[model samples]
Target chain A: MEPLFLEGKEDTPKIILNSQSNQYLISGRSLPEDATSFYSPVLKWLDEFSTQTVADPNVKFEVRLEYFNTASSKLLLDIFSKLEGLSENGKKVTVQWYYSEDDEDMLEAGEEYSELVDLKFEMKTY
Target chain B: MENNEILTKSMIYDLFKEMTKENITLLYQGDFSQNLMKAILGLTEKKMDNIEVSTNVKKKVFNVLVECVQNISKHSDESKEPPASKFTSILMLGSVNDQFIISTGNLIENKKVESFKSKILMINSLTSEGLKNLYKKIIVGHSLDEKGGIGLGLVHIARKTGEKFEYRFDKIDEQYSYFTLKVNISKIK
Candidate 1:
């Protein structure tokens, strides 16, 4: 499978999903004007990644977003739902959500996501 | 001719004076394209960086501002007068005492005013815990509307600001009304 790498922009987040390296990271700001269009490719990539066989049985996905708008919030839930599917298929999927020490909102966002999804979720403060 | 020029100059001066008196940091009125929205956010981010506030508050202001501006861009209706096909809106960001007030006004269809007002009222009626629960429920159950909105922007704003939304709707004509919304975010923890 091909690795997906998209550089972060002023309004979009950086994305890196590699099966061989086993490093799946999404970090930076996400407040695009058209979030649905911005995240369509990402959702497609994740959908493809879920259907394929991978080398690693255990996957740790890291999310370090500084801020994201409400539209992007919905998409993040979609991303987590995809991860949940992978977990149900017997892969050990863990989500490491990182937030700034002073950012209570981000921490709460991670907590809410954790409650909604069935996965090993960890909230870390930087 | 000289009197007309004098009147125009005085009008401009009065506008400046009013804005200054209000302590407006930014004011924009016109079309809100995607590029313009990004530029507005960038400009506000820079302005917010200089303010002596915690990072959390700044992020909250920025987040709320994004939702407000996007709301205008997404839902504001066009005036049916001279310019029949343009979305024109006004955004004003002012600092009052210890709070940052973000105000936006735009044209909206008269038929939708009731629903919009009720949405705000319902959101304002929720406590913090209730707002959080509603946000979770909506995010989980709701999908994007025809305009690409999941209807979570107001809920998110209410949750972040922890304040009631101030809004008004003035009838512009039989078809449309001018809608205004004001959201305040306190700098103090």
Candidate 2:
């Protein structure tokens, strides 16, 4: 599978999916006007990544969203749900959730995803 | 002569003057697009930078602002002819005595008012912990509709600001009503 890299915009996050490193990174603000459309390609790539790879890929997700709107929140959950499928397939999945030390809400958001999905989530503060 | 148009213009002018007198940081009333939203958020971010606010409080205000503006863009009535931009909405941010106020207004079908009122009221009734629990529960059990949201914006706003969502509805006609939502952010978060 080829790597996926999306540069961040003012209303969208930067996404980098490196199959070689088995590292997935998403960072910056996600407040796109059309959350569903903005996230569709990423979702499609993840779906393919989860099902197509034969061997268990050591997958890691680094999420550091400054702020995301409500619509983006649902898409975020979709991303987590797909990653959970990969984890269920016995692949090693680890997630690093980064937030500013002063931002409690972002930390709590990380905790929310951690509760929903069975993945190792490391809460890192900058 | 008391012309209706003249009266309306005077009313709007008075409100504009009041907003200016109150030291509004930003006020925009027009169609809302992704670019517009980004521009507004950028301006607010710059404004927040020069102010003396805790990082947490600034983050809370930014988050609430994002949710409110997007909520209007996603759900507001855009059926008016000669469609202005993409969605018609009003966004205002101001500070009064150190407390920041973020407000958004848009049109909605009259039939939706009751449900929205109930939702806001229920959200306002909850304690902070209750709001957090509701947010968690709703996120887990709820499904996103075609609108691409699980109805968590208000809950998150309530949780972030620890303030009641002050809202109002004005019946424009039998078909539609203008809705406004006001969120107050304290300096301490």
Candidate 3:
């Protein structure tokens, strides 16, 4: 399946995922107008992606966000966990987290995740 | 500070800082996070600063602000003081030269501010790729605080701004302090 992409609004984040490139990305500020509706499809895609993955697949994803609401934050946890499963099951799932040059909050966000799990992650800049 | 002086302060820039008409100064309350956010987006687009904002920066600032606001709306019930409990927060969007500052004030205990500070500092030290990995780790371990955020809320605050997360703690009463978070949103090139 092709990755999902949605244009972000003032209250939502722009989401783009390409299953072919295996380069999934959820970027932009993600304080969605309705948290449930916005993230539901994204979560759905990830679920499908996981089940459809071939053995020994290489799945790459990037999440570059500066802001997300509490509800959306829960969804991020969900997204990361799903990707983690994919990685553990003999797949090369690389996650690239991009932030600003001096964004301490985003950096710490990455660190918190790192401390929480044993998996390795790539923190980057654009 | 007399009543007359306080009354005069309502004339826009009367809040200690000089402000132009384009600058935004507003307080947010109720369960109106979405409506407030929509209004903010319109203001941001209508007034582009000197720097070009890539879509990335725009998303970060907007997303984070909305989350912070919603947090106030959600957690207000926990407030012990009746008056302070009802007051949501002060959110302002203003600029100095080419720099745009988004500042928010909310009631939080002293310790939370310390944690918030350290978290931002840690995130500030990493590369974007490293942050990505960290995001995953937090998810699996469930390291997020109970109130909200995956701990990366502050992380995203730092990452999006490309600047430090400037904060201040003012003791409101014997119990809580008004925490303020500020960031600069540079225009994308």
Candidate 4:
């Protein structure tokens, strides 16, 4: 499968979904004016990735967003929902949610996502 | 009144004095576009950086500002013809002691005012846990509107700030009303 990489900008997050290299990450700030359009390709790539055979038995998705607006929050849920599907398909999937030590909001956000999604989430603070 | 005297120096000075008294760090009134929104965020980030606010406070301020500005840009009503003033929306960012205040106003159709007000009221009525539950429910179940809004911005804002929103609606004409919303974020964690 082809790797997906989107460079982060002032308002958008960088996304890396490379199954070949086992590197899946979505980080940086996410506050695009049109988040739906901004994340459409990402959702599409995930859909494509799910259909393919899993080379590795374990997948660790990393989320290190500094900040994301509410619209992007919804999209993040969608992304997690897709990940849940992968987990149900017998692949061990884990979400590494990283936040700054002082960012309680980000920590709470990760906790909320953990509750909403079925996958195992590891909360790491730097 | 001559055009030059319309905005007299004394009047400008008075306005400046008022803004200073109010601790307003930024004020803008005009049409809002996506590019302008980006610029506003960038400028506010710089200002916050200069002030050396804590990382958490800065994140909260930036988050609230993004939602408010985007709401104005996306949902604000537009007239069929251009209005004379051309300042259809206004945004003000200020700091008072330990709190950051974000205020935004925009035109909206009068018919939608009741529903908009009710939505805000409902959100304000929720407790922190309730707001969190509502946010999760909406995010998990609701689809984005045609404008890509899932109607979660206000809920998210309420959850983040843990403060009730202050909002007002002023009748502009038979068809339109000016809607204003104010949010406050405490710098102290």
Q: lDDT tens string, model 4, B120-185?
A: 999999999999898888888866762246258888889889999999998877778888899999
Question: For model 1, how many clashes?
Answer: 0
Candidate 2 has a DockQ of: 0.62
Candidates, ranked, DockQ: 4, 1, 2, 3
**Candidate 3 per-residue lDDT over residues B1-189, each given as its tens digit:** 466764575764554454455555454444546676567666665654444665555555565556555555443223567645755566777766556677777777655667766776687687867665665555455643532552645554554555666777776666667777677766543
Candidate 4 lDDT over A25-72, as tens digits, reads 999999988888999999999898888787786999999999999888
Q: For candidate 4, what is the total of clashing residue pairs?
A: 0
In angstroms, what RMSD does candidate 4 have relative to the true structure? Answer: 2.0
- The lDDT of each candidate is 0.88, 0.82, 0.64, 0.87
For model 2, the local distance difference test gives 0.82
lDDT per residue (tens digit) for residues A40-70 in model 1: 8888888888888877778999999999998
Global lDDT for candidate 1? 0.88
Model 3, stretches more than 4 Å misplaced? A1-30, A33-126, B1-17, B21-32, B49-60, B67-86, B110-114, B117-136, B143-150
Which digits, one per residue and each the tens of the lDDT, describe model 2 over residues B93-174? 9988869999888888888999999989999999988887888777667666633442588888888888898989987766
What is the C-alpha DockQ of each candidate?
0.69, 0.62, 0.26, 0.71
lDDT for A68 in candidate 2 is 83
**Which window of 10 residues has the lowest lDDT sum in candidate 1 chain B?**
B142-151
For each prediction in turn, the share of the native Cα contacts (below 8 Å between chains A and B) that it retains comes to: 0.71, 0.71, 0.44, 0.82
**Comparison by lDDT, 1 against 3, better one:** 1
Displacement of residue B123 (Cα, Å) in model 2 is 0.6
